[model samples]
Target: GLPKSMSVLRVNDLVLAAYDSGIRRLEPRNGYSPGQQDSQQFWSAGSSKCQGWDSQGDATYQVLVQEVNASAPQAEPYYMQILKTCELDDATGTVQIATRCSLNGEDVLHYRGDQNRWFSVHPAAWRVAERWNQAAEVFGAMNHLTPQQCQSWIQSSASFIAQQTAQPTGHMALVPRTEARPRRLICHVTGFYPRPIKVTWEQGEQDALWEQLSSGILPNGDHTFQIQVSIELGQEGAGPTEHVCVVRHSSLANTTLRVTWDSQPTVQTVTMEIVVGCLLTALGVGALGWYLRKK
Candidate 1:
């Protein structure tokens, strides 16, 4: 049954909730120089139907990329494609490499290479094709680039931006581990470029007294970065439950950002649950005492 108040939910909210419960969780224009216009790029490559029990069986593979707004300097994105074949099926193997120059979604050239030889949509692109072939940069190019390597560019790009371009911003949160394990206080720092950054847990203004549980820096996927520094709460925790996520990054020159979390409904909710449990236990004990007295 739905709640009466929940009837007000917008259609979009219901649809999103369904996906979120299961944990479900375009391009830029062309430019004169690489910097003039915003550009968006996507590249993905993978293989399917890898196992073939017999020579008569053929496996399938592919790589697909849809790109927009790469018109100038970067207009020539090096590309090469290769396919291998033999007279007998048992002896047959295939190679595919594709790289190209593009403008406004139009192909400047598509270079498909076989062996060391290459052919291009534009004859002048042959030289670039040869270079890509020699370097063996291809979609799903097992020899030159691995599937992991092909897909890692996006993540690496984020890491690069975090380490080279932005500054760090941060805050702290209470992270409750398993009930049996120690709860931890975490300092989260994100969105600073030039990822050479540090986050420490501090009490008041004094230097951090406890060792940080290193939660390595990770990319936030928008040319930004994030990292977590944590400390486990022991039986006899030190100083204040009040703490700070001390942030240090290139963006903040001679400055550190210290952020704190609110003690909100989280405290109220826990207290309420404890009170309810205690009340239920008292009722049970009273019921048992009455039963014994009646007997």
Candidate 2:
């Protein structure tokens, strides 16, 4: 078995990498678009999903190369982290890295169990929040995130969300560079109309407070315009609740993008398990008492 301490430390290191560098723009070196290279970076670490031991008394371990967003041109774009967890099988001492590909727009497993399994994860996946534990530490270091980093996160978040919704456009945020009580959120909104639009905030169903909007026109180089707006929610209550930015476009329906930042509670849960010996002892005592009563 792997030392628990070493496993924990390895996890911490990966999480720190996630925190210091948002996972989206980080990607693996293979099967990626070079055009997107201007936006991502790479990090290598060991995987914690399994230990150095298996049921058959074989030693096994994995190392992963993770690709995350680097600070770049946009504050944030479609961000992602691709992990290729490679394992060394002690039985054969063979090293293998998992690989995946899309077949007709669907991810299908094609390799053998013995081939290898690189756990490909997306920020949009289920375990993302939990996978974020160590990385969450750097999120608090938002002040250290450069403008390039912010651009990467926002742009990447927007792109990914849009792809999921098939909307072709939307907005997202990267942690901001200030230490306010509620945390800072910077967003970039994209759409097809390419005209100046109204950006305002509404909390839950109530009217919005702390509203500010700035607008500019960007060239798409395709005879189209890219409209950009910036607003800050530097106020109380903006934290610990859900806030929606209602973007009224010149041609599209009023699109409402929501953001929520409730502080994660700092509580750890522990479960106590009894040993088999203790269980047998309790059962023996119960039987003994029953026998004495009968006597």
Candidate 3:
């Protein structure tokens, strides 16, 4: 479980980082809900989708590191990516970060599960948002994700996205709880053209509750892009029959994929159970009365 007080504190810290980085108006944060992973988001704003425009105006910026690991025993591209995430809401901004070690078009190390926070605004950002997350830094440290390296990756990602047609395909699921941890609903999007995508977790047909996350656009070895969002299912009360993972990409605008939790007791089912219980109770009473009369 996350410390309730720290998520906002962490947000303040990242805010300071962005401010120090010369981003005057760029805001960063996910929807902050105490101890709930899904309710959180990276506090930046922008769109990855290229709507026939070379850039996403002033809302978008990029920092990336794509350098070959000079010391790796095998050939691979070690990459670290960061992006400002935007969503359906009119919030200010939030940043997203991700790292990977890919070889021959496949990720030798892909972040998933509890450690699975990418494009998150899904998982807690406080844990990783600081110092670009030490884990990611450690991975990038070997590859030398210096400012120069990041600049190269930024240029490469822009060039690749410009010339590519990879559109993100998303998979949504509720992961079962493990060892008392809450279950997480994860939306994994992959194979997208041009990498800039808006993955939103929506409740009931894009209702008032929605979350925006960033996967920071990483390569799939096939010249494609992949990203993900995850949130913890907190003490749900047979809840939220309607859940969806909405993927807005340049190729498929506002594309949505509905997701559901495991079989929860529906209202109809609960009513039926109550009715059966009452009938059984009545039958038992009737039998007891008849026996008393016979006695």
Candidate 4:
């Protein structure tokens, strides 16, 4: 009677396990696997207990399905989903847990971890929500176990988490000068992980302290991050002036990267100048030869 049901356990964005209809389903994905002894033991215990947990879940789902069918025979297809989430704030050492349920893509019930109460989102589910709230022991046990399970999972995945760090590559380019606006220099740092990074402009040996703008760190498709910093040239003129882009990130060996840009003539400009000079020289030589022959 239950419509298609699936459950997933995740840490941050990585999936640890997935189940469909109380049966474990395995597929290739960028999921975590335990390598350390402690992690291995934790994984083994959790996996071994999953079978019993699934059995209980199957029985509960059957009851819920039958109840729904009895109540609403017209709505033949019904979907019931349960989501349990535990979020941790590393800086504050705070953990927040939530238990939520949805029916046909609409939230129907939510458990308030702080207040220890279940609330109905849909009017029709008010009775069901009240019934759940009356059974405090069920949700209470889940609330108590969630934080411990999250911490254990975090500890088990520490090594794999650490391996997620990635180093960044940086580049510097000059924005084409325009009649309406001043020329600008842009520094792009890409393919980095663990987010926190600093980018600045430098002139000579010190910080430029010029007006600049930044595109805050953004995630890449490959799970890395990128950022861009740009500074106004402000009538620096055509003369050669050196500017440097300094980057600091944890992934770097020395935690620092520098890219330099100078206002020098481009290859195309230099080549054009050479061609013009040769043409002028040839014309001058021809004019002088004609003058001598006529004289």
Best by TM-score: 4
lDDT per residue as tens, model 1, 131-230:
5457644423323322344233323333323334566755455656586767676665666665568777767667666656875655453445566677
lDDT-best of 1 and 4: 4
Q: Could you tell me which residue pairs clash in candidate 4?
A: none
Indicate which candidate wins on lDDT: 4
Clashes of 4: 0
Q: lDDT for every model?
A: 0.41, 0.32, 0.39, 0.62
Q: Over the stretch 1-295, how does candidate 3's per-residue lDDT look in tens digits? A: 3111111112211111122122222232322222322212322321111221122221111222111232233454322222222111115332223343222332333232224333223122223333344554333322222334334334333432344465565555455669877666666667765546677666655442433445454434333556667655565652434566667787765554443443545545544643554455455444323221222
Candidate 3 Cα RMSD after full superposition onto the native fold (Å): 24.1
lDDT value, residue 189 of candidate 4: 77
- Per-residue CA lDDT of model 4 for 1-295, tens digit only, reads 5324444565644455554543444332345676555656755565555544566655545545554556665555655556676777778767787777654455666776777677777666677667777883664223333677777767677677677777877766566669987777777677777778888888777887668998666545445667778888875653115678888888786858887654435645644643554455455434323221222
Best to worst by TM-score, what's the order? 4, 1, 3, 2
Candidate 3 error regions (>4 Å): 1-163, 207-216, 238-241, 254-295
Q: What is residue 82's positional error in candidate 2, in angstroms?
A: 49
Alpha-carbon lDDT of model 4: 0.62
- After best superposition, candidate 2 residue 50: deviation in angstroms? 69
- Ranked by lDDT, top first: 4, 1, 3, 2
